[model samples]
Target: MWPYVAGFIGGLLAAGMAAAGESYWRRRRRTKWIPQELQRFFRVKDSSRLQVLQKSFPRHMAPDAKRGLDQWLAEQGLAARLVGVPITESFINTTGLSALMAPQGESWYQVSSVEYESFDVGGDAPMECPKHALWLLDGGDAKLALFWTYGTHRVGCNWVERLRIEAGFVMDSPGSGLADQVLARLEEAVHSGHAYRGQVLSLGGEDDYRGNASGVTVHRLRPVARQEIILPEPTLALLERNVVRFAEQRPRLRKFGMSTRKGLLFYGPPGTGKTHSIHYLINVLQGHTTLLITAEQIGSITEYMTLARLLEPCLVVIEDVDLIARRRDESGVGEQCLLNRLLNEMDGLRPDSAITFVLTTNRPDALEAALAARPGRIDQAIEFPLPDAAGREQLIKLYASGASIAPEVVASAVRQTEAVSASFIKELMRRAVQFHLECRPDAESAIILQNDVDQAIEEMLWSGGPLNRALLGAGEGREQP
Candidate 1:
């Protein structure tokens, strides 16, 4: 009984709507409301009547089209004027790529049909269509489509149905595979150390993530990891011992005052591959989060305290502590404050806290005496002195073993250099090989010649000796000026 009653009601409602629509259509069809331009294009032949009716029609029909067109039409005394000039300009630019206007005796005819267009507005610039300009079609409508191109190009036209395009021309659609790609790309950027300055995941409004290529580069204050970079079997074994001890024993050792927090201070000559070793550590310690901070980042001692305290459960690296942690009296009051702040933060972290602080310095002696005195403050101080022959050979292998350098040349260069850090040796090899290659671009591609290595060594012996001497002197001295 109820089902029949519901069906009867629905049928009556449908019939009433149909009757109303039919009546409205009949009335509208009989009404004399033809547009002048349309009538002219159709060749209605009643030009005088249309002109009279058009002249009487209000001048402000298309608000966005009227400004420029109204002026033109007013100047020409057209039968009807178009409004909304900016909107119309955008409409024409987007839809027709170029709108065609034909003189209809008393009015201008718009020949093209309306089309949707969109522009991706994030990143450095907006996405573009060659012939079409994307426009805002729905002034009052919430959901808007954007796309514009000259009418002939059909390829980009179909993409207008997608909701939005994220950075790098990626389109996003609901329940679609492409949307997943966009989200995954964003997640990769975030996880791979790209810091989000803005809400990047949300696509509701215009703003997207804009930041440095690798998020924030905290000026690493310490060696984020051990910097005594050596490929020697003995050195590797020693490092492995420490790493194994830390990984395996750290958990049990925590109760006996041994901390899960590890600190390695690399005190050695410049060019000892201290920086390179840190990079290697960052690469190896994949599971753990790391933050690199330098002394230069400590604007005032106060800011250092704040940053260090905040970025906990992370590796805080101080790159050159010989410059930053110098004795307070040896430098300015500002330097003293910075050293103090660093000291406080280093001492402040709890024993079991996840944060690991690594400080690197060429001159450990120049550091404030008391800074290193705090027990458990600096758990281990590993030194990276000038590399021995074996270390040099390993470094040469690492640096020049890339597909570009010839293996024979790498061996010859490694053997010739004396007592230089891995860094200096690599620099020499890089410069010498580059010079040799550039000098003989058309020559057979092969190992860097022994002659090239000798020349580089000679150049460094004469021209570079002074720089090294100066650095050695500064390392031993009170301060670097």
Candidate 2:
């Protein structure tokens, strides 16, 4: 009886140990789960949370973090606004904060705080005290802030403790570098210290400004292929500079108005890649989203201004702003308040915020003086004129090289053709491709012949009064020239 009792006890102990081992393995596997944005934000080299947080060291750390977080929230369709100045509508307390929901129809959520005692990776034992207090708000999505200082500054609270309080569950003393990273991201986000006014619309029609244009047709601009864009030396240089600006802007991308956004005015003849270039710029600028608006969307200056201020770090592309905001070649239209709103939106009081304005028109002289006078209103007034001889050659090469056209013959055809915009050339090439596909094996190779290109050009030149009249004549025939 004694031996039987002992055997049963030993068996029970062994079973308990086996169960404990399985539990440990299961916990390890579950801990490996990581959110996609978090993985991208930290560039997680290891599974440890400390290791992941430490690795996110982009130059503009704060903005980068905000962007990462914003993107995740946007994917979830949550509205996130970077609250700058404290607004009467945005309430706060010792534990959390809240803001008035924008774009309407969205409900508000309570802000809460969490204390993470060991988020830091190095130095003695990680600070066990509450490191920071975070403010979480719904902006079409969740936007969380780990602040640096919130309460009683005069007291003998160590800067490290303050940092911890600000950073929430993160490191206490993130140092200037880490602090800057976090601050840069939250620059546009409102805190208790800043001042804010009741947001008003400076421009936009009532329906759109009121967020009621559900079925409105928006001009969703698409980018021309890289091969199709003939980058002249000066334009190429500008493109490179824009790319650098975007790269430097990575961290501050979430912060509205950190650096003045550069707006390019593409004005010239129609089908000159003006619209297409806008899309190209968008593609080059990573993490940048383009919002295309027409004059119809903005009925007044007040509505437009309201939209611009409310939406930061957005590209407001106003196609034919000259129609509404321009001085108006036709007299009575000059007194338009819409122009005032656009000018203010572009070069208004809040120049430091993160909203960019892009306008394109065939006649730039039509724009109002007040609108263009603003120092940074039109950072780079690029004119997308008709392609020159060299530009034409490049266009031909881009269009025909994909096909089996003879290089020398294609070059000759390009030289023979009159000056045309990149858009026209693109149309010509597209037709060539279409014809080639239609006549595939029945016609020799799957290549567009020089003759086919020539025919396409001839058809374009003769089909319209403008192209035919212009090509037949010479001297000052081109608009820009």
Candidate 3:
């Protein structure tokens, strides 16, 4: 019985050791086989070894880069030979003893590539991709081979799609010049602003802004006209002169020794027309790109600045800026660092760069002194105060332009809405229109009478309680200043 037990234990130990050895060798062979297969498939000659250049990009931008590079190669009259290699679950699972002992004809690289249609959220388009592809281009004097693969990148617990590109050339070719030309073309294709024009880009990512491609969500913005924004004449004039004029006459400003990059601060209560005014600006500057960064995305402020520089004549809007630009000493180290980055980026802008930094905050006192107190950083600080009687009247009429409200009703509502914001007036007009619609649903030409306006004003201002006033952006009329 003792001999039988000893023999059984020995057999178990041997089996475990054999399995471990087989596993190690399988992984080793699997890793070595792919590169060997790539070399053989390309028929890389003994006299000419492969020189490789590699780059990685967010999966979203990879297709664009590949297409751009392919187009560029075709334009240069280079013939492209494409070979795709499939990576299947069976291949991955068999990456042990089975892989090592597999015949050359049965290798993973020999498998025919599978193509799939990938949906792009950026636009209404579907792109095609294989699991992995190698592109060979004949550059007359030099032969270039490009390889691209798609994979998942784990960022913390989140998985992000990533694309890796590797380019190989003959060792005897003009390596530096050829590589630079290819890389320069790729860079231009990747950074081209054609894709982001007339769209609002919000910063994305956990800690850093990865520029337009990797860390951004493109928003299609609806253009607002000048008449839609109600502000004091002087404030409108200031915005036109400082922001609009700066963008329009950037070259002229640079020629005159004036800095083309201007920073404008909009400080006021929540319900004022600060953001509305920004929308108007966005509309007027139709050709230029606009970047909208919320307080939560302030961590990517530096990245936003970099993009602004690249996309010149760009508007960088930072809403609720006081969240990140708090006084240095009173804030945490991270907040202070963010404030410093903001100042540095603003200061580092070239005079000829037509980049406008538009920052808005309800609390100006909470901002860092270096940002607001400095002269060069903030070129203009425009206060967006609550609309006075005249402004409110104009806002009511403007918002009620399509409605059947009379001028007298608007005038009456304006008189009662003192210290209310342009937003409040707009909401009042909206409620009045709704009331009229409810009372006379079948009346296509129903008029919004003074009684409707009066009822809306009373419900929003007097009877609906403090919460209603706050919700409609009426209670906070005065700026802290």
- Give the candidate number with the greatest lDDT: 3
lDDT of 2 by residue, 1-481 (tens): 9999999999999999999999988974554221222223233332243211212121111222334434444554533222222212211223221111221111222222443322211223322222232333333222333332222222232111112123211223233333344444444332211111111112222243422221212333355556656757787567546543654674575375356565666677666666666666666655443466777655433434443454454566778877776665553554476566566556653545555666788777777765665566777676676778788777777766557667776677666556566766777777777766776756654577766776666666655556453443321344321
Please list all clashing residue pairs in model 3, or write none if there are none.
Answer: none
Best by TM-score: 3
- Candidate 3's clash total is 0
Q: What is the C-alpha RMSD of each candidate to the true structure, in Å?
A: 22.6, 17.8, 7.6
lDDT of 1 by residue, 151-226 (tens): 1112332211111112111112221332233334433332332221111111112232432211122232234344
**Which stretches of model 3 miss by more than 4 angstroms?**
1-37, 44-48, 56-64, 83-132, 138-142, 150-163, 173-180, 205-214, 476-481
Instruction: Give lDDT: candidate 2, residue 143.
Output: 30
The local lDDT score (0 to 100) that residue 286 gets in candidate 2 is 51
Model 2 Cα displacement at 280 (Å)? 1.7
